[model samples]
Target: MKQPLADAPASDAGRLQVPTAVLPLAFGVLGLVVAGAALALWVIPAVPRLTIIGDELVGLSYIVAGTIAWLRRPSNRIGPAITGAGITWFIGDFVFVPNAVITALAYALMWLPNLFAAFILLSYPTGRFFSPAARALFLTAVAVSAAQYAVRLFVLDATGDYGCTCRNPFAVLPNVALYDVVMLVTRIVVVLITLVTLVLIVQRWRHASPAGRRQLAPVLFAGAVGLAAFAADITAYNLTKASADAGALGVASVTGTLLVLARTAVPLGLLFGLVRTRLDRALVAQLIVQLGQAPSPERVDEVLAATLHDQTLRVIYWSPAARAYLDGRGRLVEPSAGEGRAIRLVERDGSPLAAIDHDAVLTDDPELLTSVTAALALAVDRGRLETMVRAQAEDSRSFPTGRVTLLYSDIEGSTALLDRLGPRYADLLAEQRRILRGITREHGGREIDSRADEFFAVFPMGSTPLAAAVAIQRRLRDHEWPEGATVKVRIGLHTGEPEIGDEGYVGMDVHFVARLGSAGHGGQILVSQAARDANAGELDHDDLPADFPPPRLAK
Candidate 1:
């Protein structure tokens, strides 16, 4: 069995219970606090008006969205990555630092948020990269970004460079031509990688399943829009710088604002996808309702199949007595995971009750399965009990006994019927056994032994056994059987003090009961004199034929 994601106790509504919602809650609080601090930076006289406001909004949006995602799915790494990007975006504003060392450090780390955004786009839905190609692209993006920053820091001094007034304290070898060439090449490489990443995202979306598509749609939409806006922002800024014209500057400003607004959709889309991709609570509710009314194993399977939307789903119970898995019919079943199918073990109180075999897609949302199983724990436990009962019946056992009456019965023409019916006879036989067991239990008798089409039961001294025999006769006579097959049973009753051990009644009385049952014709019930005496006044003498013969002892 797979362990739950969180160790917190289960809730009444089956949400992911946590020890406290504090940790992620604190992350959200701190993110907002940092965003507020950045807002203060926006009001500082040294920062550019458009740059400060745009940075603040973009950073705040990512922080808030990241906070929501992290709180919703704390185990996922994507949330923290996004939140880190937002924090770094805010920190990058330290390019306004008066201290030369701090300004240089800030410039080196300023472009990191872009690299983070690239990783986020390449690894949507699942927080991890699924293919080597994706990993390579992510690594390339990081490498190119680092190279660009390094060249800008050492070869191109920021003092009186690129319209920056801050001195480049970390500049070692000033080579303006080399710096521009390296920066241009890195930018071109980064653009190509971004295009490749976009293509990969499209391919993944095309190959995704219906459920997968639902999860990817929002994030993909947001990412594409953000990328487009980013490209436009870069184009406009370059055009404005090259032209030195008022109209170009106006276009750059408009594009920059649009870029900030467009980037907001990326985090919003991720948050939307996370919130939307949840197991339908209604399905779990319906399951709880169905289970409340004593559903059979088949009904349980149907409910689960509908709930999980996997029609091929199967519920196999673990029989502790048999030490194996069994189907609903109590027949042995071997469950293995393969071929786009998987099995999840359902447990209660740390003991295995059953296994749910379902589509492998469900593995993406294991918490849903865990919650559903917790809710269905009672039904699963009941199924375990039913499985044990059915297994015991199929593999009948003997028990210790004292003074009691024994009844042995067999279907008269079972062998011939089986020959005629072939495999269909199994169903008929199962029904017959069911009827017999029901009648036995009704008459206060215990079925101690059963094999093939035969049953051996013990009852207390009373007319109950006689009544059960007659009831079985009438039921078999009137019941509608398959293929117009007639069902007839021969029962033998004997009263004696039999010494029953682990293997059941062991004395001559048991053999005597078998012999008496074998001698009787179809639909006949033969009783020993001892049974007749024991039931004396309770036995309806009128029901017995007047010409019935006296009991004979077995040699």
Candidate 2:
């Protein structure tokens, strides 16, 4: 059996239960203290008032929003990424310290939070990034940042850059010209990275389905704006002839204030996207109302597609009797979802109930997926019952009452033939059944029941059963059997008013006919006196023996 995606945690019945919010809460408190220290020690004393306030707000926003997201859905890694970004953002403020070693170290690693930003955007919705180009680009950014840090620490002096009055203790051989050249190249590369990031976000949006687009929209909008603003602000500040004035050092200029404001949108957008699952929960509420009681499978499918905003969705019901998943029309269907599709299994009482095939976007929001699936449980079970009923009705044979002729037939030496043919027995059995059914249908006979190599059919009245029996025997003799094996069938005919039951003909007449068929030799037809009397002289036209053996009924 193919295992369900949701069954992962439930597999270990004895696993210890862990509270989801414990770590987030603990880490959130710790992050608050760190952010406070950063603001009090470095930001407030050194930077302009507006920049100090912006730093506090932006850091707090990241931590609070990330904590909430983590509490809401612990499975998504995006939450942790956001929270860690906040902590690292504060940590990077060590660049404002007056100590040479600490400030140099901070300057070397200040791009940590920005790297986190890139990761959060590229891997939006799902925390795990999948695209090869995206992964490569992120790694490239890391490599470039590491190189820049090495160059800044050993090859260049930054005694006055970003208003840092402290001397660079790690500058081994300061070269002003080389520093300018390196800075220029680094700026160009940063611009290129920004452009690539924008292109990637646009590509993702364009390729996404409608449902996927909804999930990506808010985050993409905020991320794109933030990247553009950062690129523009950096270019304008660096390329222009603005002097590195000591008085203006660590001050929040108008452009710096705008940049910080733009940065604030990133966390807000992430928080908005995370909380947006409430809208899906609302849809689930409506879904429950729309479902009501005893809704059809098609209705369940429609409501799910509408609620989830995934139009290409289908529900396949599980039939316990059939031991398979079946469609609304009771046709067998595989649980597999084809290209660009995904399957979510639905279970009742820990047993497989049904599966939903829909667009892959639904997997991004685990909370919504779980909610919608839980809402659909009762409806899917009802649909399963309906599908089973349909299958039973289709398999059942309609029986005729009153006086009727019943014919029973079976392959002679079936066990021995099966042993001889091995796998080829299936082909022989299929051909035999085909011939028997065709002859019975041609002579106005309806099949009452059939199991394996044995067949039981009912005819309306005189001569039809005999005619069908003769035709069956003749076809078996003339047709070439499979596996180069000779095949023969034994037939018995009886006429009586056999009682009809829910499962077709019952009572002694039915039993007698079955037993009589078993007693005959291959290629031979046995008839009872009752049938012979009812259809007198029918054997003459059938080309059967005039002196037929008495019906040998064996119990």
- All-Cα superposition RMSD per candidate: 13.3, 12.3
Highest-TM-score candidate: 2
Winner by lDDT: 2
User: Which residue ranges in model 2 land beyond 4 Å of their true spot?
Assistant: 6-22, 42-46, 73-75, 162-164, 241-255, 382-555
Q: How many residue pairs clash in all the candidates, one count each?
A: 0, 0
Model 2, position 210, has a per-residue lDDT of 91
The superposed Cα distance between candidate 1 and the true structure at residue 174, in angstroms, equals 2.1
Off by over 4 Å in 1: 1-30, 46-51, 71-74, 96-104, 159-164, 231-255, 277-283, 293-314, 319-323, 326-333, 339-341, 359-361, 383-555
Candidate 2 clashing pairs? none
Q: Spell out the clash pairs found in candidate 1.
A: none
Residue-level lDDT of model 1, residues 1-555, one tens digit each, is: 333344455564256445325666676678777777667765556666566677777887788778777776677767877887787776666666556776677666677788778878877655788578999999998889889789867876764312245667778988878887887677667667767877888898787655556656887878877777666665654555431111235776676567667777888787675555453655687788887654655777888877766677888766553456666655567778866577787777777677888776667666667766776677766543542374366336544356688899998888899897888787667656655765776678777767888888888765388888877776676555656678788899998889856556788999888999877767789989988877655545454434534543455
lDDT of 1 at 145: 86
**What lDDT would each prediction earn against the true structure?**
0.70, 0.74
